[model samples]
Target: MSEASLLKTQVVTLRVPNELKSRLEQQAKSQGVSLNNLANYLLTTQLSQLETLSGIEQRLRGRNLNDLKQKIAFLLNKVPHNPDLPEWDRL
Candidate 1:
């Protein structure tokens, strides 16, 4: 055994939907790895991606007004314009 493998690790108790657990088990079996290993790999990879995106977001914050407005406009254009609505739905 390697030194890294011998290092102490904390246990985390996670509650997942039965269907999701079954899918994860199937994936782990197909990859010839234990469920714990697969979950660790997925969590580590996703956290890295989120950290990268967060860095980009922080750097872009309060940097561009026109660009942000254009992006918002582009998104707003994708929504269908409808004035007809029930009184309860009107803001």
Candidate 2:
């Protein structure tokens, strides 16, 4: 956990399938970016997505599912049905 270790970038070699690698290379070429840059973009955003999902799970950890369901039902019932869309009443 030293500062130098944190700042260092190590090369990683992945054994990806040939077809996937070819597709990634083609996409990077079409976008006028280096394959490395494209891979970096994908890896960084995928991690970001996991971070966002973790944040959502953390925020909802203490929520009660039954209470949420009841609240949603109450809110749905309170909404006035449009006369033009009578199907809403059946739903």
Please name the candidate that would achieve the greatest TM-score relative to the true structure.
2
Candidate 2 lands at a TM-score of 0.64
| Residue pairs of candidate 1 with colliding backbone atoms | none
What are the per-residue Cα lDDT tens digits for candidate 2 across 4-59?
Answer: 89778879999999999999999999999999989999999999999999999998
Worst 10 residues of 2 by lDDT: 82-91
The ten-residue window of minimal lDDT in model 1 covers 82-91
Per-model TM-score, in order, reads 0.63, 0.64
- Model 1 off-target regions past 4 Å? 1-6, 65-91
Which portions of model 2 show Cα errors greater than 4 Å?
1-8, 69-91
Compose the digit string of candidate 1's lDDT tens values, residues 1-91: 8999878789999999999999999999999999999999999999999999999999988878899889989998888767897778754
Q: What lDDT is reached at residue 1 by model 1?
A: 88
- Tell me the deviation in Å of residue 58 in model 2: 1.8
Q: What lDDT is obtained when candidate 1 is compared to the true structure? A: 0.93
